[model samples]
Target: MVDNSQGHSAYSEDALLVSRMNVKPGGKQAHMRDGWFMRDGVKVIQQMVYPPDHPEFPNEPKGMKAVLAECGLSQQRLRGKCKKCESDSLACCYKRILELQADFQEQKSLMQEVIESMGHLSIFLLKFTAS
Candidate 1:
């Protein structure tokens, strides 16, 4: 039990569980802290910060250059492909990469803006109150 201005209250397992925000794939990347459950080939729940020193995993390529590199079809490989399907395959892969890049950029920019704006706001508020 702990007390301050407010009266003391009991703490229990339920309280601990309720405060946790589980960040699983369906709930992944939420801008809040959550506890996650782990299971086969997936994390059922994920915490806000990844576990300490977590190893990075492979992510799907999201740019034209990255896709071409992953598919082993860089400029040289494209040249080696049969003429009939050469342009078609390249166009398809390029389109996919552009789509991925668009999505990734949208998400990345939004995250950056949110963090910066919030940090600035916090600083301003602190300075304002201090004066």
Candidate 2:
């Protein structure tokens, strides 16, 4: 139960889950509270500060670079400027997620082809390897 100037309401189980997730592991006390989900907090902060489709950031890579700079991280991983950047805010996340999914699917397909080519020899090799 929590009380405020407005009123009091019963705390739900979801509230408990949220509290537990924010707690640091091993009971170590942390002054700075974090989000319930374990993700890139800096990236989340950057996203909040400079949303995907912000006017200044019509381009995704530029916006991401700016945010990374603010967070004191070098943009070594980001490739050169993108010629065609998505304008829609939702589309930004969607496009990157789809690209990642496609890459993963391609890798999975390649792995399957390799496994198929290995055939019975792979199984025999696996059996001999130490557990």
Residue 16, candidate 1: Cα error in Å is 38
Which regions of candidate 2 deviate over 4 angstroms? 1-44, 48-55, 58-63, 75-131
Please give, for residues 5-123, the per-residue lDDT of candidate 1 as tens digits.
22122232222121122212123222332333324655444333434454542221122333334334334322212324433443433333323332222322222344456764212
Poorest lDDT segment (10 consecutive residues) of candidate 1 = 16-25
Poorly placed runs, candidate 1 (over 4 Å): 1-63, 71-91, 101-131
**Residue pairs that clash (backbone atoms under 3 angstroms), model 1:** 21-34, 21-35, 22-35, 23-46, 36-45, 36-46, 37-45
So what's the TM-score on candidate 1?
Answer: 0.19
Candidate 2 lDDT score relative to the true structure: 0.29
Which residue pairs show backbone clashes in model 2? none
RMSD of each: 18.7, 21.1
How much does candidate 2 score in TM-score? 0.18
